[model samples]
Target: MTFSHDGLRDSLTMLAAPPYFYENLRRELATAERNRSRFTLIRFQLFPRDEQASLASEESQYELAILSFAEVLKTSVRAEDLCARLGRFEFTVILKAPSAVAESLTSRVVTSWSSHQEWSKTALCKSAIVTAKIGESSLEILNRLDNQELIGITQS
Candidate 1:
Protein backbone atom coordinates (compact mmCIF):
# COMPACT_ATOMS: atom_id res chain seq x y z
CA MET A 1 0.00 0.00 0.00
CA THR A 2 1.98 2.87 -1.32
CA PHE A 3 0.94 6.29 -0.06
CA SER A 4 1.55 9.14 -2.44
CA HIS A 5 3.31 12.17 -1.00
CA ASP A 6 0.14 14.30 -1.00
CA GLY A 7 -2.02 11.59 0.55
CA LEU A 8 0.58 10.90 3.17
CA ARG A 9 0.85 14.58 3.96
CA ASP A 10 -2.92 14.93 4.30
CA SER A 11 -3.12 12.00 6.68
CA LEU A 12 -0.25 13.27 8.74
CA THR A 13 -1.56 16.81 8.88
CA MET A 14 -4.62 16.21 10.98
CA LEU A 15 -5.00 19.86 12.06
CA ALA A 16 -4.02 19.07 15.66
CA ALA A 17 -5.79 17.90 18.76
CA PRO A 18 -3.17 17.06 21.31
CA PRO A 19 0.05 15.08 21.27
CA TYR A 20 -1.78 12.21 22.93
CA PHE A 21 -3.93 11.39 19.89
CA TYR A 22 -0.92 11.30 17.63
CA GLU A 23 1.11 9.28 20.09
CA ASN A 24 -1.75 6.81 20.47
CA LEU A 25 -2.20 6.62 16.71
CA ARG A 26 1.50 5.99 16.22
CA ARG A 27 1.39 3.18 18.75
CA GLU A 28 -1.61 1.64 17.00
CA LEU A 29 0.17 1.91 13.64
CA ALA A 30 3.20 0.12 15.04
CA THR A 31 1.00 -2.68 16.33
CA ALA A 32 -0.88 -2.87 13.04
CA GLU A 33 2.41 -3.36 11.27
CA ARG A 34 3.10 -6.49 13.34
CA ASN A 35 -0.28 -8.11 12.54
CA ARG A 36 -2.02 -6.52 9.56
CA SER A 37 -4.12 -9.26 8.04
CA ARG A 38 -7.02 -9.31 10.51
CA PHE A 39 -9.28 -6.87 12.33
CA THR A 40 -12.54 -7.60 14.12
CA LEU A 41 -15.44 -5.62 15.56
CA ILE A 42 -17.16 -7.53 18.34
CA ARG A 43 -20.40 -6.16 19.76
CA PHE A 44 -20.77 -7.51 23.27
CA GLN A 45 -24.32 -7.12 24.45
CA LEU A 46 -26.23 -7.64 27.68
CA PHE A 47 -29.85 -7.12 26.91
CA PRO A 48 -32.16 -7.78 29.80
CA ARG A 49 -35.14 -9.62 28.44
CA ASP A 50 -38.52 -8.04 28.92
CA GLU A 51 -39.86 -11.51 29.32
CA GLN A 52 -37.52 -12.19 32.17
CA ALA A 53 -39.58 -10.09 34.52
CA SER A 54 -38.25 -12.15 37.38
CA LEU A 55 -34.85 -10.61 36.82
CA ALA A 56 -36.38 -7.15 36.91
CA SER A 57 -36.93 -7.32 40.62
CA GLU A 58 -33.46 -8.57 41.31
CA GLU A 59 -30.90 -5.78 41.18
CA SER A 60 -28.32 -8.30 42.26
CA GLN A 61 -29.12 -10.29 39.14
CA TYR A 62 -28.21 -7.33 36.99
CA GLU A 63 -25.03 -6.91 38.98
CA LEU A 64 -24.26 -10.56 38.43
CA ALA A 65 -24.93 -10.16 34.74
CA ILE A 66 -22.50 -7.24 34.49
CA LEU A 67 -19.84 -9.11 36.44
CA SER A 68 -20.35 -12.15 34.30
CA PHE A 69 -19.91 -10.09 31.14
CA ALA A 70 -16.75 -8.52 32.56
CA GLU A 71 -15.42 -12.00 33.13
CA VAL A 72 -16.12 -12.95 29.54
CA LEU A 73 -14.33 -9.93 28.14
CA LYS A 74 -11.36 -10.31 30.42
CA THR A 75 -10.99 -13.97 29.56
CA SER A 76 -11.78 -13.63 25.84
CA VAL A 77 -9.04 -11.50 24.28
CA ARG A 78 -5.38 -10.57 24.39
CA ALA A 79 -3.92 -7.80 26.50
CA GLU A 80 -3.34 -5.59 23.48
CA ASP A 81 -6.92 -5.68 22.21
CA LEU A 82 -9.31 -2.74 22.68
CA CYS A 83 -12.64 -3.02 24.43
CA ALA A 84 -15.03 -0.05 24.20
CA ARG A 85 -17.92 0.47 26.52
CA LEU A 86 -20.59 1.59 24.12
CA GLY A 87 -23.48 1.49 26.50
CA ARG A 88 -24.75 0.19 29.78
CA PHE A 89 -25.73 -2.99 28.00
CA GLU A 90 -23.12 -3.22 25.27
CA PHE A 91 -19.42 -3.24 24.39
CA THR A 92 -17.44 -3.12 21.17
CA VAL A 93 -14.17 -5.00 20.92
CA ILE A 94 -11.36 -4.42 18.44
CA LEU A 95 -8.72 -7.11 18.04
CA LYS A 96 -5.45 -7.57 16.18
CA ALA A 97 -6.52 -11.00 14.88
CA PRO A 98 -8.24 -11.56 11.52
CA SER A 99 -11.92 -12.17 10.69
CA ALA A 100 -11.77 -15.88 11.36
CA VAL A 101 -10.32 -14.89 14.69
CA ALA A 102 -13.28 -12.62 15.25
CA GLU A 103 -15.73 -15.40 14.43
CA SER A 104 -13.92 -17.69 16.81
CA LEU A 105 -13.91 -14.98 19.43
CA THR A 106 -17.64 -14.65 19.02
CA SER A 107 -18.04 -18.36 19.59
CA ARG A 108 -15.80 -18.27 22.62
CA VAL A 109 -17.70 -15.28 23.90
CA VAL A 110 -21.05 -16.99 23.47
CA THR A 111 -19.82 -20.24 24.90
CA SER A 112 -18.34 -18.56 27.91
CA TRP A 113 -21.50 -16.53 28.31
CA SER A 114 -23.59 -19.68 28.14
CA SER A 115 -21.54 -21.32 30.81
CA HIS A 116 -21.86 -18.28 33.04
CA GLN A 117 -25.58 -18.05 32.45
CA GLU A 118 -25.98 -21.68 33.28
CA TRP A 119 -24.21 -20.99 36.52
CA SER A 120 -26.49 -18.03 37.09
CA LYS A 121 -29.56 -20.09 36.20
CA THR A 122 -30.31 -18.05 33.12
CA ALA A 123 -30.62 -18.68 29.41
CA LEU A 124 -27.68 -18.61 27.04
CA CYS A 125 -26.23 -15.35 25.72
CA LYS A 126 -26.60 -14.16 22.14
CA SER A 127 -23.76 -12.60 20.14
CA ALA A 128 -22.79 -11.44 16.62
CA ILE A 129 -19.84 -10.13 14.62
CA VAL A 130 -19.82 -7.61 11.78
CA THR A 131 -17.50 -5.89 9.36
CA ALA A 132 -16.46 -2.35 10.11
CA LYS A 133 -14.56 0.10 7.94
CA ILE A 134 -11.67 2.38 8.77
CA GLY A 135 -10.91 3.77 5.33
CA GLU A 136 -8.00 1.88 3.70
CA SER A 137 -7.83 -0.87 6.32
CA SER A 138 -8.46 -4.50 5.29
CA LEU A 139 -11.43 -6.62 6.32
CA GLU A 140 -11.93 -10.23 7.42
CA ILE A 141 -14.39 -12.97 6.43
CA LEU A 142 -16.71 -13.32 9.41
CA ASN A 143 -20.17 -14.82 10.03
CA ARG A 144 -22.11 -12.24 11.96
CA LEU A 145 -24.48 -14.06 14.33
CA ASP A 146 -26.25 -11.14 15.87
CA ASN A 147 -29.54 -10.99 17.75
CA GLN A 148 -32.94 -10.79 16.07
CA GLU A 149 -32.42 -7.06 16.48
CA LEU A 150 -28.94 -7.46 15.09
CA ILE A 151 -27.35 -6.44 18.38
CA GLY A 152 -26.27 -9.97 19.29
CA ILE A 153 -28.18 -12.13 21.77
CA THR A 154 -31.70 -12.90 20.68
CA GLN A 155 -34.61 -12.48 23.00
CA SER A 156 -38.38 -12.88 22.84
Candidate 2:
Protein backbone atom coordinates (compact mmCIF):
# COMPACT_ATOMS: atom_id res chain seq x y z
CA MET A 1 0.00 0.00 0.00
CA THR A 2 1.19 3.53 -0.74
CA PHE A 3 0.89 6.30 1.80
CA SER A 4 -1.65 8.93 0.91
CA HIS A 5 -0.78 12.62 0.59
CA ASP A 6 0.53 14.33 3.74
CA GLY A 7 -1.28 12.05 6.15
CA LEU A 8 -0.34 8.67 7.58
CA ARG A 9 -2.72 6.77 5.30
CA ASP A 10 -2.60 4.32 2.43
CA SER A 11 -4.66 3.13 -0.54
CA LEU A 12 -4.45 -0.66 -0.26
CA THR A 13 -5.18 -1.76 -3.79
CA MET A 14 -4.53 1.63 -5.33
CA LEU A 15 -8.20 1.35 -6.33
CA ALA A 16 -9.23 4.81 -5.22
CA ALA A 17 -6.69 6.92 -7.07
CA PRO A 18 -6.01 7.58 -10.75
CA PRO A 19 -4.89 4.77 -13.06
CA TYR A 20 -1.46 6.33 -13.33
CA PHE A 21 -0.15 4.37 -10.38
CA TYR A 22 -0.89 0.98 -11.90
CA GLU A 23 0.54 2.28 -15.12
CA ASN A 24 3.74 3.26 -13.37
CA LEU A 25 4.03 -0.11 -11.66
CA ARG A 26 3.40 -1.86 -14.93
CA ARG A 27 6.11 0.18 -16.63
CA GLU A 28 8.63 -0.45 -13.88
CA LEU A 29 7.90 -4.14 -13.94
CA ALA A 30 8.49 -4.20 -17.64
CA THR A 31 11.79 -2.44 -17.24
CA ALA A 32 12.91 -4.72 -14.45
CA GLU A 33 12.08 -7.85 -16.38
CA ARG A 34 13.78 -6.58 -19.49
CA ASN A 35 16.93 -5.57 -17.71
CA ARG A 36 17.04 -8.70 -15.59
CA SER A 37 17.11 -6.57 -12.48
CA ARG A 38 15.10 -6.77 -9.29
CA PHE A 39 12.17 -4.45 -8.87
CA THR A 40 11.54 -3.39 -5.32
CA LEU A 41 8.40 -1.52 -4.39
CA ILE A 42 9.38 0.45 -1.32
CA ARG A 43 6.20 1.32 0.56
CA PHE A 44 6.61 3.92 3.26
CA GLN A 45 4.16 3.05 6.00
CA LEU A 46 2.40 6.24 6.92
CA PHE A 47 0.45 6.78 10.13
CA PRO A 48 -3.27 7.42 10.57
CA ARG A 49 -3.99 4.48 8.26
CA ASP A 50 -7.72 5.25 8.34
CA GLU A 51 -9.71 6.85 5.55
CA GLN A 52 -10.61 9.80 7.69
CA ALA A 53 -6.93 10.46 8.25
CA SER A 54 -6.25 14.07 9.05
CA LEU A 55 -5.53 15.98 5.90
CA ALA A 56 -2.58 18.33 6.00
CA SER A 57 -3.90 21.84 6.49
CA GLU A 58 -3.05 23.05 3.00
CA GLU A 59 -2.11 21.56 -0.36
CA SER A 60 1.12 23.55 -0.22
CA GLN A 61 2.27 21.72 2.87
CA TYR A 62 1.30 18.44 1.30
CA GLU A 63 3.29 19.30 -1.79
CA LEU A 64 6.33 20.12 0.31
CA ALA A 65 6.16 16.78 2.05
CA ILE A 66 5.80 15.00 -1.25
CA LEU A 67 8.79 16.88 -2.65
CA SER A 68 10.78 16.09 0.44
CA PHE A 69 9.93 12.44 -0.03
CA ALA A 70 11.13 12.66 -3.61
CA GLU A 71 14.32 14.36 -2.56
CA VAL A 72 15.19 11.62 -0.14
CA LEU A 73 14.26 9.00 -2.70
CA LYS A 74 16.51 10.59 -5.30
CA THR A 75 19.40 10.82 -2.90
CA SER A 76 18.88 7.20 -2.01
CA VAL A 77 18.61 5.96 -5.58
CA ARG A 78 20.63 6.27 -8.76
CA ALA A 79 20.18 9.11 -11.17
CA GLU A 80 19.45 6.75 -14.04
CA ASP A 81 16.86 4.90 -12.00
CA LEU A 82 13.14 5.43 -12.01
CA CYS A 83 11.57 6.29 -8.66
CA ALA A 84 7.89 7.08 -8.92
CA ARG A 85 4.84 7.43 -6.77
CA LEU A 86 3.19 4.13 -7.54
CA GLY A 87 0.64 4.96 -4.85
CA ARG A 88 1.01 7.96 -2.62
CA PHE A 89 4.15 7.08 -0.64
CA GLU A 90 4.54 3.76 -2.35
CA PHE A 91 7.28 4.11 -4.95
CA THR A 92 8.24 1.60 -7.61
CA VAL A 93 11.92 1.60 -8.49
CA ILE A 94 13.42 -0.45 -11.31
CA LEU A 95 16.95 -1.08 -10.27
CA LYS A 96 19.38 -0.89 -13.14
CA ALA A 97 20.96 -4.02 -14.66
CA PRO A 98 22.26 -6.86 -12.46
CA SER A 99 20.18 -8.06 -9.54
CA ALA A 100 23.06 -8.17 -7.05
CA VAL A 101 24.17 -4.68 -7.93
CA ALA A 102 20.63 -3.40 -7.67
CA GLU A 103 20.14 -5.04 -4.31
CA SER A 104 23.27 -3.41 -2.96
CA LEU A 105 22.20 -0.06 -4.33
CA THR A 106 18.76 -0.36 -2.77
CA SER A 107 20.28 -1.28 0.56
CA ARG A 108 22.29 1.89 0.64
CA VAL A 109 19.33 3.95 -0.47
CA VAL A 110 17.13 2.49 2.26
CA THR A 111 19.79 2.86 4.89
CA SER A 112 20.41 6.49 4.04
CA TRP A 113 16.73 7.37 3.80
CA SER A 114 15.85 5.76 7.10
CA SER A 115 18.07 8.22 8.93
CA HIS A 116 17.19 11.22 6.80
CA GLN A 117 15.48 14.06 8.66
CA GLU A 118 12.16 13.45 6.88
CA TRP A 119 11.90 9.82 7.89
CA SER A 120 13.19 10.54 11.39
CA LYS A 121 10.19 12.80 11.91
CA THR A 122 7.78 9.83 11.50
CA ALA A 123 6.79 10.15 7.83
CA LEU A 124 7.84 6.56 7.27
CA CYS A 125 8.75 4.24 4.41
CA LYS A 126 9.29 0.49 4.19
CA SER A 127 10.84 -1.54 1.35
CA ALA A 128 10.45 -5.00 -0.20
CA ILE A 129 11.95 -6.51 -3.33
CA VAL A 130 10.36 -8.74 -5.99
CA THR A 131 12.54 -10.42 -8.55
CA ALA A 132 11.30 -11.35 -12.00
CA LYS A 133 11.26 -14.95 -13.14
CA ILE A 134 11.69 -16.04 -16.78
CA GLY A 135 8.06 -15.49 -17.72
CA GLU A 136 6.89 -13.20 -14.94
CA SER A 137 5.43 -9.77 -15.54
CA SER A 138 4.73 -6.61 -13.59
CA LEU A 139 1.44 -7.88 -12.19
CA GLU A 140 3.33 -10.82 -10.79
CA ILE A 141 5.71 -8.46 -9.05
CA LEU A 142 2.72 -6.65 -7.56
CA ASN A 143 1.26 -9.95 -6.32
CA ARG A 144 4.62 -11.02 -4.91
CA LEU A 145 4.72 -7.87 -2.82
CA ASP A 146 1.60 -9.00 -0.94
CA ASN A 147 3.31 -12.19 0.11
CA GLN A 148 3.78 -11.78 3.86
CA GLU A 149 6.85 -13.98 3.79
CA LEU A 150 8.85 -11.04 2.51
CA ILE A 151 7.78 -8.73 5.26
CA GLY A 152 10.53 -6.87 7.20
CA ILE A 153 13.20 -7.84 4.69
CA THR A 154 14.96 -4.60 5.60
CA GLN A 155 13.71 -2.18 8.16
CA SER A 156 15.04 -0.77 11.43
**What lDDT, from 0 to 1, does candidate 1 have?**
0.51
lDDT of 1 by residue, 15-126 (tens): 1122332343345545555655445556666654556464446666665575577667768888877654434445556666667888788777777776664433443355
Write model 2 residue lDDT over 47-154, tens digit each, in one string. 322345442534454445555556666676766655556555455555544557656765676566556555434444456665555457656766776562432223
- RMSD per prediction, one decimal? 12.0, 7.2
Off by over 4 Å in 2: 1-63, 148-156
Alpha carbon lDDT of each predicted model: 0.51, 0.52
For model 1, state the Cα shift of residue 49 in Å. 4.6
The reply for model 1, stretches above 4 Å from the true place, is: 1-38, 49-57, 118-124, 134-156
Using alpha carbons, what is the TM-score of model 2?
A: 0.57
